[model samples]
Target: MFGKSLKVFGILLLCISFTGCAKARYAAPEPETRVVGGASRAEAFRFTPSGDQAWLSWEQKPTDEEYGSFILKIGRANFADGSPLPLDTAVGVEVVLWMPAMGHGSNPVALEKIDIGTYRVSEVFFTMPGDWEIRVRRTTEAYGVEETALAIRI
Candidate 1:
């Protein structure tokens, strides 16, 4: 009985010591958002700009029947300061790919509204290896229209 009591006391002391040595906790930094064309931005989308590819996972709202679509959750990351500005009040989004060096562009592709703000585009393939630009035009509720381009090289 005495041996059992000592073991229990030792365990209790060890647990108490661990509890007393608590480490400070720090919160993660909030993602940065900017107001552009009267819209709020969030790190709700992710893409590898260097690869000349884009994948967005926006908040799913009702799918736009006019623009039938699919979902591709690419994860989330904040957009770098300036360039490729994201609009909050975007009601319509379109993507176009152009190869400046080759002096040509891929076939026209339409982006379908899959979820609320989530959009999916088909046939965005780079046929040749060279400099490419993906231009995006967003129809905003307040600003009327906003455009940004993502440059990439292969």
Candidate 2:
């Protein structure tokens, strides 16, 4: 009886150890929203009128709808104190790219969907600007409408 009890205890210990290991190996995948906006989610580009042109780039996160729509709006502002201008008074602007059925909505340029969570390059031009705000309005099937804004100095 003693030997049988000892064997049962050892088996129980081994089962417990295996269960713990399995639990340790299991990890939930990071959410899509968190991954897309990793570091530059809210980051804005800064420019100083180099050669009368500046390159703008940003990341956009999409939902799991296979297809979605978004609107990109670029705003130009004349700042005196080096501060970012308000969203309401952004004038003298240009629409670099406008695409439909793509990840980004109406604009001047077309952005092709590269992968499930990535988008192609969308470029814009700033003509002698003091401050420019690059705004993206994304509409997903799951998350409705989301906005991402970036400010650049030129």
Candidate 3:
């Protein structure tokens, strides 16, 4: 009887020791922000600029090394009352690729206006592969700096 109790105690002690000596675990760091204003998690490939009247979308990313890295984007904007922006608004757009984990950004991208509301983003080079934020900005005298950002894992 004593031997049985001792065996049970030994098993319990062994289990307790194994559990008590477990190594501490750590988790990967989370992205500081989801998008633009840095609020809740954003899962958007399309976003609205600061003016809250413009919508933007990005396409053709994750470029290969052999081919030049570039991104294509499109936008549509309207006034406060939802009227489309005038043709003479003279809007300009730019793209900036930033890696938040490393606190660094890629080379300045070349912006080519494809049409009234479309652009071909070029020269977007990334040093390392990690989570990146693609910041898109549209500027006009009336809207000032209408900007938006989207987080993506590359």
Q: List pairs with backbone clashes in candidate 3.
A: none
Tens-place lDDT per residue, model 2, 50-145, is 111112334443333322223322223335643233232221233332222233432244455443333354433333324434444544344444
RMSD of each: 16.6, 17.4, 11.2
Please give the TM-score that candidate 2 achieves against the real structure.
Answer: 0.31
The superposed Cα distance between candidate 3 and the true structure at residue 98, in angstroms, equals 0.5
Residue 56, model 2: lDDT of: 32
Total clashes for model 2: 7
- Candidate 3 lDDT by residue in tens digits, 1-154: 9999999999999999998887656543333443222322212343333333333333433354622333344433444644334233436677888887788898777778766654567666666666787787667677676666666655
Best by TM-score: 3
- Stretches off by above 4 angstroms in model 1 are 1-88
Off by over 4 Å in 3: 1-60, 67-74, 77-90
Whichever of 2 and 3 has more TM-score, that candidate is: 3
Q: Score each candidate by Cα lDDT.
A: 0.48, 0.37, 0.56
Model 1 is weakest, by summed lDDT over 10 consecutive residues, at 61-70
lDDT (10s digit) by residue, model 1, range 1-154? 9999999999999999997787546543322332222222322322322221224322332122222222332222335642233223456667776777778886676566655445676645556556666666665455565554545553
Which portions of model 2 miss their true places by more than 4 Å? 1-107
